[model samples]
Target: MIRKSFYMLWGTQTVSNIADIVYTLSLVTLVFTQSGSLLTTIFIPLFRMLSKMISGLVAPLIMSRLRLTSILMGSQLGQFVIFTGLIFYLWLSPEVSYPIIFLAVFGMSFLDGWTDPARNALIPRLAEDEGLMKANGLMSVSDQVVKCSGWALSGVIVAVIGAIPTMWIASVSYFLAMFFTAFIRDPYAAAGVQAADKVSSAASGAGDVARKPSYGEQLSEGWKILATNRRIRTLAIVDNIDTLGGAAWLGAFILAFVVEVLHQDASWWGFMNTVFFIGSIAGGVFIVARVKKLQKNAYLWMLFSLLAYVIITFFFAFNNVPMLALILFAVSGLPVQIAGIIRRTLIQQNLTPAETPSAMSALSVLSNFTFAIAMLLLSWIADRYGMRDMYVVAGVMTTAAVVIGFVYRSAFREESSPAYASEENVAVNKA
Candidate 1:
C-alpha cells in the first residue's frame, strides 16, 4: 500500500513537472515572437521568482491549517483553471500582452511554491526510514528524466503545434495531475483534524483566553525553528553557500562559455545541456541502486559528492576541447545529483513530520533568495571578467564552503527524537 501511494504521487509530480516545462517554453516563445522585446521576455522569469518568494514565505501558515493532500490537489486544480482561462482568452483575443503574460506566470509560480514543499514533506509520511533514501533517489530520477525529455521536446512541440496549442496540452497535464493527487492517502489528516478539534474545544472552554496563533507568528515559526536548531541551522547555511556558487551554471554563463571559450554556436550550447541532464540521470540511477548502502553514511556521501563536483568543475573550466568539455560537463552532473539526494533524505530523517513542512518551506525560501542574489552577482562578474574566470571562482568557492561544512560535521550527528521515532515506527508498521 505504501509503495502504491508513493508511485501514484511520483507519477502525478512527473506529469506536473513536464507540464511546467512545456508551459514555460511556450510562454517564452510567444512573448518573444509577439513583443520582440528582450526585456519583456526576461520579465517572465523575474515574475516567476518573485511570485515564488512570496508563496514560500506564506506556505508554512497555509500548510499548518490544511492537509498536505488538499494543498497539493488545490495547487494543481488552480493551475489547470488558470491555463484553461488563458487558452480561452487567447482563442478569443489572440493578442499576447506582456502584462497579461506576467500575471499568468505569477499565478502559476505562486501555486508551484506550495506544491514542492508539500510533496517533500509528504514523502517521509509515506515511506519508512529504511526506505526513505530509495524514495528520494527515485524522485531525483523522475525529475531528471522529466527535465531532459520535457526541455528537449518543448521546442519541437511549440514549433509544430504552436504555443497556444501547447498551452492547451499543458492544461490537460495539470488536470491529470490533479486527478492523481486526489488518490494519495495522507495519514496525518486524521491527526490534524483531531488536533483542530481539541483546539476548538479548548478555545470554547477558556472563554476567549485561548487564541489561535496570528499569521505573523505562524509565519515566523518556521524561521525560528531553523534558526534555533543547531543541526538545521548548520545545514541551511551550507546548502545556501553551495547554491550561491552553483548559480554560475545559469544559461547566461553557459552561453558565454560556449561562445567565447569553445568558439561554438548555439547548437553546442543545447548539446552541452543534453549531456549534463544525461549525466544527472545516470547519477540518479546509480544512487537509487545503492540506496541502502549510501543511507548508512549519508553525510560522508554528501561530502564526497561535493568534492567530486568541485574537482570536475575546476577541470572543466580549464579544458578547451569541445569533446572533452562535453564529457566534463556530463561528469560534473553526477556529484550534484548524489549530493541533492543525500541532503534531502538527511533533512527528512532529521525533522519530525509536524516540523517537516515548515522546515522545507524555510529551506525553499532561503534557496530561492540566495540563487537570485548569486545569479545577479555572478552575471556582473562574468560581464567584467571572462566566463572561464567566473567558473574557476565558483569551483573554488564551492570547495571552500564544503570544507567548512565538514569542519562542523559534528552538528549533523543524529539525536533521538520521540516524534520522529514514533513517525518512523508507524511508517514501518504500515510498510
Candidate 2:
C-alpha cells in the first residue's frame, strides 16, 4: 500500500508540475504576443489569488465528495481538458479575447488548488504515524524537484518548437498522470461511523470497511477541535508569519530588485525562481531525516525556522550584491522546507481523518490571506516608504512571533497517544 501510494503521488506531482510550468511559459508568451504590458504579468498571480480564495471556501466540499485516489486522478483529467482547451482557444482562434483565456485559466487554477490539501491529507492513510513526516518530506522534495526540472525542460520545449507544443507536452503529462494514479489502491476508510458507513463496502475498491463520517458534521467537529487545539492554532499563525516573510523575498520585493537592482532583462525572472526552487529541493531532502526530530520538538523547530527566515529577510532587503542576496535566498529557502514539513505532519497528527480536509481549507485561507496582504503591504511600502526600509518592518513583525511562540510553547508540545503511533512507522522497510 505504501509503495503504491508513493508511486501514485509521484505520478500526480510530476504531471501537475509539468502542466503548471508549461502553462506558465505558454501564458507569458501568449500575453506578449497579444498585449505586452508589464501589468499583464499580474494576471498570473491574480488568478492564483482567486484560486486560493475560492479554495478557502470550497476545497473542503470538493475534497469530501471524492475518495483521495479519485480526487487525485480526477484533478489530472481536469487539467488535461483545461490545458488542451486553452491551447486550442489561444493559438487556434486569434479572434478570442484574452479575458476569455484568463477566465478559463482562472477556473482551472481554482480547481488546481484542490490538489495540494487533498493529497497531503491522504498521506497519513498510506503511511503510519512515524512515517508521516517522512512521507510529507518526500512529497515536498519531489514537488520542488519536478517543478524545477519542468521549468528547465520547458525552455528546451519552448525553444525547439513553440508555446503551443510546450503546452501539448503539459497536456500529455496530465493524461499520463491519470494513467499512473489508476494503480493506487484506496487506503482511507471515511471518518465518523455514520457518514462513512454509506460508502461502498470492500467489495467495491475502497481499502477497508469504513465508517461514513458526515461531511458537515465532520467539518464542524474539526473546527471545534481546532478551537480547542492550541498547538495547531499557534503553529498556523507561525506558518502565516513564515509565508509572509517568504513573500517579501518571493513576491514584490524580488520584482523590485530586478527593476531597481539587477537592471537585467526580465527574461531572467523564471530562471531566478528556478534557482530558489532548487535550493528548496536541497533543503527538502535534509529535512526528511530531521522530520522525526521535528516531531519530537515541533514547536521549537517551528519557531527556530521562523527566526532563521526573519533574519534572512532583513539581509535580503538591504544587501547590495545580487550574489549575496541569492545566497541568503537559499538559506531563506530552508524554513519553507522545514516548516512546511512540520506543519502538514502536525495537522494530520492532530486532526481526525474526517476533519482533515476542512482543517486544511481553513489553514490555507488564513495563510493565503497573510501572503496576499503582505505582498500588497510590502509593495505599498516599497512605493511610499523605501524598498530597503520595509525590511525593518518585516524584521519587527517577525520578531514578535517569537514572543507569541514563548507564550504558546506548552500547547505545541501536546503528547500523542499510543493508538496514533502505529508499527509501520517504527518497522524497518526494505525499500
Candidate 3:
C-alpha cells in the first residue's frame, strides 16, 4: 500500500511537470507573438520564479493547517483552474494584456510552489527509511528525464499546435495531476495517533491544559529546526553555498563561456545544455543502480562529489577546447547529481515526518533566494573578470563547501541511535 501511494505521488508530479513545461513554452510563445518584446517575454519566467519564492516563504503557514497531500492536490487544482481561466481569457480577448497574462501566471506559480516541499516531505512517509534512497533516486531520475526532454518536446508541441491549444493540453495535464494527487493516502495518521496518545496522557493531569504553540512559533519552526540542529544546519549551509557557486551554470554565463572561451556558436551552447542534462540523467541511473553499496557511504559519496566538482569546475574554467569542455561538463554533472540525491536522503533520514514539510519549505526559500542573488553576483563577476574567472570563482566557492563538509564530517556519520540514523546511513560513520 505504501509502495502504491509512492507511485501515485510520483505519477502526480510527473504529469504536472510535463504540463508546467508545456504551459511555460506556450505562454512564452504567446507573449512574444502578442507583444513582440523580448523583455515582456522574459518577465514570464521572472515573475513565475519570484512568485514561487514568495510562496515558499509563506508555505509554512498553510502547511501547519493542511496535510501534505491536501497541499499537493490543492496546488495542482489551483493551477488547473488558473490555467483554464487564462486560456479562456486569451481566447475571448482579441488583444490580451501582458499584465493580465502575468497575473494569471503568478497565481498559478504561487500555488505550484507548495507542491515541491509537500511532495518531498511525503516521500519519506510513503517510502520509509529502508526505501528512502531508492525513492529519491527514482524521483531524481524521473525529474532529470522530464527536464531532459520536456522543453524540446514542448517546443515542438507549441510549434505544431497554436499556443492556445498547447495551453489547453497543459490545462488537461494539470487536471489529471490533481486527479492522481487525490488518491495519495495520508501517511501521517500514525504520527497523529502518537500525538493523540501524548495529548491524552497530558490531559490526565488535573488543571493542566497544554498550550498550543503560537502562530509566530509555528512560522519560525523550520528556521528553528535548522538553527538548533547542527547536522541539518551544516547540510543547509553547504547546500546554499553550493547553490551560490552552481549559479555559474546559469544560461547567460554558460553562453558567454561557450562563445568567448570555447569559440563555439549558439548551436554548441544548446548542445552543451543538452549534454548537461544527459549527464545528470546518467548520474541518476548510476546512483539507482548502486543504491545499496552507495547508501552505506552516503556521506563519503557526497564528499567525493564535492571534490569532483572542485576539480572539474576548475579545469572547466581553463579549457579552450570545445570537445574537452564537453567531456568536462558531462562528467561534472555526475558528482553533483549524486551529491544532491545523497544530501536529500540524509536530510530525510535526520528529520521526522512532521518536520519535513516546514524544513523543506525553508530550504526551498533559501535556495531560490540564493540563486536569485547569485545570478546577479555571478553576472557581475563574469562581466568584470571574464567568464573563465566566473567559473574559477565558482570553484572557489565549492571548495569552501568541501572544506566545511570535512570540518563537520562527524555530523553526517552514522549514529548508533536510530533516532538520528537510517538503515542505509548506519555505516556512513566510516567517513
lDDT of 3 by residue, 187-216 (tens): 675674454345445545756665555677
Higher-TM-score candidate among 1 and 3? 3
Q: Order the candidate numbers by TM-score, best to worst.
A: 3, 1, 2
Which stretches in model 2 have alpha-carbon errors above 4 Å? 1-3, 190-225, 258-275, 417-431
lDDT of 2 by residue, 94-195 (tens): 574768777867877777777777776677767665677778778888888877787677777787888777778778878887888788765554442223
Per-residue lDDT over 328-408 for candidate 1, one digit per residue giving the tens place of the 0 to 100 score: 989988888998888777777767666678888999998999999999888887888888888888988788779977987
RMSD of model 3 against the true structure: 3.4
Task: Give the residue spans of candidate 3 off by over 4 A.
Answer: 190-207, 414-431
Question: In order, how many clashes per candidate?
Answer: 0, 6, 0
Measured on C-alpha atoms, candidate 1 has an lDDT of 0.82
As for lDDT, the candidate ahead, 1 or 3, is 3
lDDT of each: 0.82, 0.68, 0.83
Against the true structure, candidate 2 reaches a TM-score of 0.85
- Backbone steric clashes in candidate 3, count: 0
Candidate numbers sorted by lDDT from highest down: 3, 1, 2
Instruction: Using lDDT, give the best candidate's number.
Output: 3
- Model 3, residue 427: distance off in Å is 20
* Model 2, C-alpha of 401: deviation from truth (Å): 2.7
**What would the TM-scores of all predictions be?**
0.92, 0.85, 0.93
Model 1 worst lDDT window (10 residues): 422-431
